[model samples]
Target: MNLHHNLTKSRLRAAYLVALLTLAYTLSFIDRQILSLLVEPIKHDLSLSDTEISVLQGLAFAVFMGIGGLPIGRLIDRSRRMSIITAGVAFWSVMTAACGLVKGYTGLLLCRMGVGLGESTLTPAAYSVISDSVSPRRLGLAIGVYSMGVYIGAGLALIIGGAVIARLPVDTMILPLLGEMRPWQVVFVAVGLPGLVVALLMMTVREPMRRHDESFAVKIPLSQVFHYLREHRFAFTSLILCQSFAAMSSYTLNAWAPSFFIRSYGWSAAQTGHAYGITIVVSGMLGVVSGGFLGDHLVAKGFVGGRMSLMGAAMICAIPFAASAPLMANPHAALLMLGVITFLITLAIGTGPTALQELLPNRMRGTVNAMAVLTVNLIGLGLGPTIVALLTDYVFADPLKLRDALAWAVPMMMLVAAIFAGLSLKPYARSRSQRLLTQQPVENA
Candidate 1:
């Protein structure tokens, strides 16, 4: 009875931790994504171009996020994850609020860079902590639940930012010390303030014990990490390629979708915000929950190949919706299609994270995650919007042709993503089989 009680208590604590961590994750994304919905207003007030906006949305964040993730991940592996996460949440919260105070591009860029630096600590530490707290059997669902933070945060940002921007006399707000601020600046302030509260909450969560034997010296130098990649070259390569392609399309659409609706269909920021925000919450919620459930179901059925299966199906399903996304003449129709695509594409996200965690031993989780994030952010988030913006500028020198150029570039990327996702299946399946074989109990002859 005592053992049962203890086990029940532990499970409840784990569930609580997952819920709190997921909420923190959601806040991180809200701070990151609010800028996307505010892009048009910022551009007009600051007299910026599409290319410049792309840099703000992509380069500024991605550079810091890429550079900061590894060290943060390393620290998380060695220290208490709760402390690391709490510090990060507080740092980014302040930086996000500072973003509202910036008077020019350079100032805003510096603040955004700070946001990236703080956000970089999140995933590596959060994943490691969750892995320790949850059982392998329930990891997919746990990760899926946690993953909802991304979409939910995005949804809230769009809805909240839209509502705030719509109501405020943002163009003429004169501060006692800072002079008149623009609507976008007001939007940033409104969106950023909540994170400070979240940061305080993050500090109160108890840290989980690190799983695995402490004396198991599995720390590979960076050189050996690369060498291990070479050993599992096919699996690593496939994972990177698949994730990169998928992320390229994902980030591009995320950054540009509101702008696209505004430019192509004459929708106001508020209208597009309400449309995309609701879709993200509804469809995105369904996709994440279903993806996790599906992955868990497949795993239970003795198909250790659940990650590949879910990813491949998601990529394939996403392609048609992506291809049709720009073709819809009505903003409503376009948003509906986009909602479907978001749901399908996002299904693969937590699958890769969970698979990598399962494939690698406990100690190297942070390093592997860092490497993955480095590649994904540098190649995907860093380049996706820039590529689309560049292509839109060069290919559509005529203003009339810009929408078509975006449509062409986005779908082609999705198709390529589908191909890469399909290619990853064989290597993922093989890796899983090998891992299972190695973990099997030895016979006592």
Candidate 2:
């Protein structure tokens, strides 16, 4: 009876931990994505072009986030995970608020870089911690719950930004000490300050016990991590490449979809925000959670490559929606198509990280996940928006032709994603087989 009580208490604590992490993750996305909704006002106030906005939206943030993840990933493995997360939450929040103070492109770019660097500490550590906290059987659902923050944060950002923009002045405002500020600047400050409270809340989470092979030497070097990746090169590489390509379309639409609505269909930002925001939250929540359950269901039914198969199938299904969504003549139809596209793209969010956790032992989880972050961010976030902007700016020579760019870019990305997912199946299955044959020990790979 005492054992049962203790187990129940432990389970409750784990649930609380996952909840807080999800909240923090949600706040991070709010800070990262709020800028997207404010792009038009910011561009007008700052006199920036789509190409410049694309750099701010993509390259500035992605480079730092991807590069910074490597060192932070190492720290997550060898250092105190909770403290790392707390410090990161505090730092990014401050940087995000600082974005409000910046008057020029350079200053804004620097603050974004700081935001990216601080945010890099989150998922690799969170994935490692969550993996330690739950049984393998329940991991898919647990991670899915945490991953919901992506959509939740983004949706809330749109909703909140829209409301704020509706209420506040888009033009410059002169305040006492702050002097002059635009509505977009105010939005940055508002969204950023809440993360400080989250930082404090993070202190309450008890560090999860690390689950690892007892025989494995502690603090394995980065070299060993690389060696292991090389040993399972096909599986890891294919997984990374497939997800990266899929991410290209995801990030592209995420950054520009509101602008697309405003430009192509003549919708107001507020209308786009409310409609698009609701769709993102509802569809994203359903898709990610469903993917987790579906992956777990398939595995339980003895499919070794269930996760990869689901991801591939999802991308293939998404190709038509990705191609046609932006081209819709009616605003309502475009938004409905976007909802479907979002659902299909986000279905892999939880499944992909869960896949990485399964592929590696605990000691290697952070580093390998960080490596995956580097590739994904570099390819997806770094280039997705830029590619679309370039196509509009150069190929079409018209900013209003953003829909044409999306129609061309997104379908191609989904196709490559599907192909890579297919290539990954056999190799991933073989890697899993080898690991199980070695009694699930990965230290000597």
True-structure RMSD, every candidate = 3.0, 2.5
Q: How well does candidate 1 match the true structure in TM-score terms?
A: 0.94
Return the top candidate by lDDT. 2
| lDDT of candidate model 1 versus the reference | 0.79
Best by TM-score: 2
Give lDDT tens digits, candidate 2, residues 1-445: 9978877877888888889999999999999888889888888878988889998888889999988999988888888799999999999999999999998999999999999999999989899988888767788888999989989998998989888888887568887787888888988999999999999999999888777656433788888999999999999999888889888888888899989988898777788788888998999899889888988888778787889998899999999998888888888998899999989988965577777677887788888888898899889989999999899888999989999999999999899989998999999888877766664432210
Write the residue-wise lDDT of candidate 1 on 1-445 in tens digits. 9978877877887898889888888888888888889887788878877778888888878899879998877776667779888889888888888899989989999999998889888888878888888877888888889888888988888888888888988457887776778778877777777887877887777887666535534455667666767777787777777777777777888788877887888888888788888888777778777877888889889887777778877887787777777878887888888888888877876566777776765566777787788788777788888887777666675434546756777777767766776777788778877767765332211
lDDT (CA) for every model shown? 0.79, 0.87
lDDT of 2 at 326: 83
Worst 10 residues of 2 by lDDT: 436-445
Where is the poorest 10-residue window by lDDT in model 1? 436-445
Error of 2 at 407 (Å): 0.9
